[model samples]
Target: MPPTVGERAPDFESLLCTGETFRSTRLDEALDGGCVLVFSAFSFSAIAENWWKRYERAGWADFDVPVLGVTRDGPYAQNAFLRYLESPFRLFSDVDGRVGEAYDLLVEREGMANTTTSWRAVFVLDADRTVTYAWVADDWISPVPREEVEEAVAQL
Candidate 1:
């Protein structure tokens, strides 16, 4: 099962596509004094880009909560997608799907492995790595509305 609202979030590290060597970011460390929003997606997909744009444009990054984008794509594709969207948030590469599997966000159906790729999902985590909210979309085009994320952060 996926992490629930009150459950502890799984901590994982990934490579950032910052051109230099990938940096390690521990979820618990990142949220040591604030909340975090983790978005799991396939790079540059319409829904992912659109939602990320909205959230960033709203200045969520400047707030106490940090937003993270995690994807199964390698650093190359992830960097390209971030450049295309002009997103300031760092994107994490989960090429092995270990991060997604740890969070139980991988969905394999009809012999197609969305787990091996990326599907739209979001997790809100508190400072101690406890999950405050979690959402995994059934369709790539659908995302938890921006307000929901805002509310989650506010609640944190």
Candidate 2:
């Protein structure tokens, strides 16, 4: 199961894509005022593209807290995805799915044998890395509860 509200988020280190370059990042070190972590199966897919576009339209970039995306794609693909979206935030490359496993978001893809990916989910973390809000999609394509997430971050 995924972390719930008030639970401490699992700390993780992964390759971070800054749209222009790649670097190592740890969850604990990235915390500031707080942050939003978005998990998806992969980058460059139709569903993933649309999901990020929705976030962009929702003004997620202007939130008081930083918003970061995590996916199993490598840094190269992540960089291209960020550039494609013209995103203001960075993305973590969970290439080995270790971060996904740590967060309990790893799952085998339906109808695809031997393939695994992170489920679509959103988490709002406070400065201390405690989960203030958490949402995991029941299915692959469900949209994130943006208003609820925004409220959670605002309260933090």
> Which candidate leads the pack in lDDT?
2
lDDT of 1 by residue, 43-115 (tens): 7667677777877887878767777778877888887787787777777888888888887777664466554
- CA shift of 142, model 1, Å: 1.4
For residues 1-156, could you state the per-residue lDDT of candidate 2 as single tens digits? 899998999999999888999989898877778999999998999999998888888988888888899999999999999999898878999999999999999999988898899889999999988999999998998779999998998898
- In terms of lDDT, the poorest run of 10 residues in model 2 is 25-34
Instruction: State the C-alpha lDDT per candidate.
Output: 0.73, 0.91
* lDDT value, residue 144 of candidate 2: 92
Worst 10 contiguous positions by lDDT, candidate 1: 109-118
**lDDT score at residue 47, model 1, on the 0-100 scale:** 67
Q: Give the backbone clash total of model 1.
A: 0
In model 2, pairs of residues that clash are: none
